[model samples]
Target: MEAARLAPEDVLPASEGITPAWPGRSVAVDGANIHVRDTPGRSATVEPAVYVHGLGGSSLNWTDLAGLLADYLDGQAIDLPGFGRSDPARSYTVTAFADRVIRWIEHSDRGPVHLFGNSLGGAVAVCVAGTRPELLRSLTLVSPAMPFLDPRRSFHGRLLPLLLIPRADWLAARRLAAIDPADLARMVIESCFADPSRFPEQRFAEAVEEARLRYTVPEYTSAYVRTLRSLILSFVRAYLPGSASLWQVARRISTPTLVIGGQRDMLVDVRVAAQVARTIPDSRLLTLHDVGHVAQMEAPRMVARAVLGMLSEASSVKLVPRTGASERPKRARRNTKSKRDIPFGGGITPAGEAAG
Candidate 1:
């Protein structure tokens, strides 16, 4: 892959004190060695957590959230096949990654787990939940990829050419390499943050390091292109009659769910994440106004609170289906009332609840 990467001399760690902690083990998935980080001791709790990361991210990406998550449900984070230290695989797709995830679960102490996913992983978790609801207690999706109602809005959607066009992929990668790695990394970081100043310089440096490694690695360009292409393809065809967008699938999800979205995300619109919550009967949604893309990284404490909040709600919600007789016949027998608060103000619902 062609990469605009930074050299070791010109680029340095973002902060002097920051240390990216990576502690874990190795497992096998689809014949590829998978790296894992487990919270000590078997979880003597109700929830067994398994986290999945976004495109171009690995298990290490969840470093910030692990300790907080462990305080809730002692769990581990594992690298998906062909990412991180894991050996490159035959293919990278939702199904392929899901299969690997299922294998990991089977061999883990956390099968039938509560899953957490961000971006690309969020989509995978949703697909897996569709086929194996029994294996999942609930799902927590952070800014999952959704179908574009307006293709022109998202930067990634509009930048699709960087991956789709022939040879452009190579050219971009090469250009990326020639440019200062730290500078390119900053561009990416700044683009994602609501307030770029809030971005951790240390984390940005780590990103640069990762970029350099990815660029130097053979087939990295192809892998990056393929990953981006697959992401777009999945979003475009998320749902039909049989297979719908993951958001659509979320509506049918019987498992308790929490949908977290970044209000300022330039890539995946916040509106879609709200839709994901609305579609699911047992789901609650939280919109982080200042964070983008990777919320846990951007605001770890808030993300932790949200995750814990969802778990608390999930614990109280019984999985039993809601059943009731149709009230439409009786509704026609009674008079209906409606009121409007007027434009530039608010409105009252038919049920009399005021909405602003």
Candidate 2:
């Protein structure tokens, strides 16, 4: 197997203007109203792709990436229950989140679609790929929030202790409520982006607006806090020697997968990126320097190029299996050199070559 490389044609032009968030509408799936921002493909023949954002992120997170991929994919970025304009869900567990995504795909009759996830969404995508292999054409994970014990970032370390307290979600919400929406948005941008200056002013304003709207939603802060707590619990379960660990789930996934990570990520350790690629049976990894947790947002064009490369390979080989099939789907040839480290502004290493 060869490493996935970005071709000259795959590089998005720098002159391409940033697209605003696609128009969103509510769709009911299993009694839950999911808000989805739809980006129509360049043609009806283009395949479908679904994007799921990380914890505390909404469908808007995929605005740029989805827009860039619209020529090849009809994309839908969904706001999970209790986020964006969606109603609160009864549960916030990772399994519950995966179930929602599965239901949405089934309800929309869009099986065997390209599934893309970031952070928490990546974990949810892992469950979906493992449990319902036939529902995905391929899986792309961006800095997935897999269970890691070492909280290198101060923010994560501070938040971990709060999970031990009773009614911590309420307490956290109360504290968050005291902060200004703009300040909160700024903090998020600072934490998520390796270079905060790269964030567009328009997007920053939209994030501020979203933060203010969140304050109006009664369940907003609680949803964020509880979801974080659930994710932390999942980390515990993943580390324990058990069949239910996320690593085990990754091992079971047969879909062609692309795992992208940020070398300078303040949250997830970059070394884990290689482990993720090695764990997934048919996977490739890309590590980008000078980027942080939200690589999809920080480097949409580069992300889009890698995604297109994967899609090209998947389509050329017709790797997607029929829905509801019992047999394991065909796997792509395993890449001997599964990981590639891309410099912030430099040439890429060729496929199957190790980057120094």
Candidate 3:
């Protein structure tokens, strides 16, 4: 079956009142202090959901969307090691990030929870879902940094050459130090949002504050550089035929998936969005026009509505637990009605063709 495409008007707008970042605390996982922002669900019956941010992004990125989904999800946005308030880790590889997430979920005993990731985090989430399908009830990727060989497609392309320069991290740090945090924040807002003018002033202030804090962390620059380099290398590996690439991992994913992308995303091409849905066996696609890289931040209410619809559909099917590493979870009979049958604030029109 083809993936459904949601129209701009079909999505609801976020609440007018902005909420502060969710309450956060440090949790020890695998000998590392991982910071997490916790959003209390409206009811005890709500399922657990974990949100992961992209490279150079912090847990604060998820504040609005987590709050909006509070009724159905007990959400926790995690600051991957070296980002946000989290302590630095020895390694910044995607696999390492995925390992930390796995340990946290195991430590919290929150297996089979809903998982969401944006950009780099989307790649990490893909790693987790592919290797440990038993750990996720569903997967949602927002503008995932999939392997795209064309460097011209994203702003990130400019930095790829830096990976070859010796002590590039130090050079990058010195360069960033020259820019004011407020200016850095503005750059981010401009890059991530199709309409930067539409961003709330208060939110921009918060972003500036977060950027200032990140600068104080000694490992911030190195972490960012290493992670970016690693991600690009992974992309290169993904292109090699017959290799165990992310695309290969994505095909193995069995969890229900939702892939969201902004039409104007400057970092990840919007065309890649449809390709992602087509890659995953049980996945849907959402491409929002006029939106940018951070759809969750740019269109939280719309993201929330699509998420709720997926959750509604997932609830109808029963999942059997995996008894061994080699065993795939058994899925019970799914409802005859398509996921579109589950209302998402309004009617939706299937793109009428397979995702590209």
Q: Which candidate is the best by TM-score?
A: 2
lDDT of 3 by residue, 302-355 (tens): 777677666666654222222342232222322232221232332222355325
Candidate 1 lDDT (Cα, 0 to 1): 0.63
- Which RMSD values do the candidates have, in order? 15.5, 8.9, 9.6
Q: Pick the candidate with the highest lDDT.
A: 3
**Candidate 2, after superposition: displacement of residue 112 in Å?**
1.2
TM-score of every model? 0.77, 0.88, 0.87
Q: Which should have the higher TM-score, number 1 or number 2?
A: 2
| Candidate 3, backbone clash total | 0
lDDT ranking of the models: 3, 2, 1
CA shift at 194, candidate 3, in angstroms? 0.8
**Model 1, which residues run further than 4 Å from truth?**
1-19, 41-46, 167-169, 244-248, 316-356
Q: Please report, in order, the local distance difference test score of every candidate based on alpha carbons.
A: 0.63, 0.79, 0.80
Clashes of each: 15, 0, 0
lDDT of 3: 0.80
